[model samples]
Target: MPNVTIYTTMMCPYCFRAKKLLTQKGVKFDEIDVGTDPGLRREMTTRSNGGQTVPQIFIGKRHVGGCDELFALEARGELDAALQAA
Candidate 1:
């Protein structure tokens, strides 16, 4: 399984959706909650190339962008390949 990491915040639907998709794929992920951690948020921004969003996802060091992008990967039938990239 790939090393999945997701920077998330509470009450964000996009974050929820991202988690749901990952769960449906049965992949374990490290979920960093930046809701109350400014430092983690900054880290997330740095990892995501200044993307300061609620759900900044990374799969095995690969920056996968946010929820919409993730779904786009699934639409393109590439999500499974990404998960296997670890």
Candidate 2:
């Protein structure tokens, strides 16, 4: 399994949905709560290339954007390939 990291915040429905999808895919991820951490939030934003959203997800070292983008990948049948890619 590849390394999965998700920068999220509490009370964000999109974050919950993103995590749910990952869970359903049997993927373990490192969740970083940026609810109260300014520095971490900045980090997430920088990592996401100006994406200041609640759920900035990274599969290994690849930035996968937010919930909609993630589901889009799944819909296109590209999410599994991304998850399994080296």
Across residues 1-86, which tens digit of lDDT does each residue of candidate 1 receive?
87999999999999999999999989899999999989999999999999998799999889999999999999999999989875
* Native-referenced Cα lDDT, model 1: 0.94
Question: What is the Å distance of residue 79 in model 2 from its true position?
Answer: 0.4
Writing each residue's lDDT as its tens digit, candidate 2 over 16-69 gives 999999999999999999999999999999889999987999999999999999
Clashing pairs in 2: none
Give the Cα error of residue 28 in candidate 2, in Å: 0.2
Best by lDDT: 2
Per-candidate Cα lDDT values, in order, are 0.94, 0.94
State every prediction's TM-score relative to the real structure.
Answer: 0.97, 0.97
Give the RMSD in angstroms, all C-alphas superposed, for model 1: 0.7
Q: Residue 54 lDDT in model 2?
A: 76
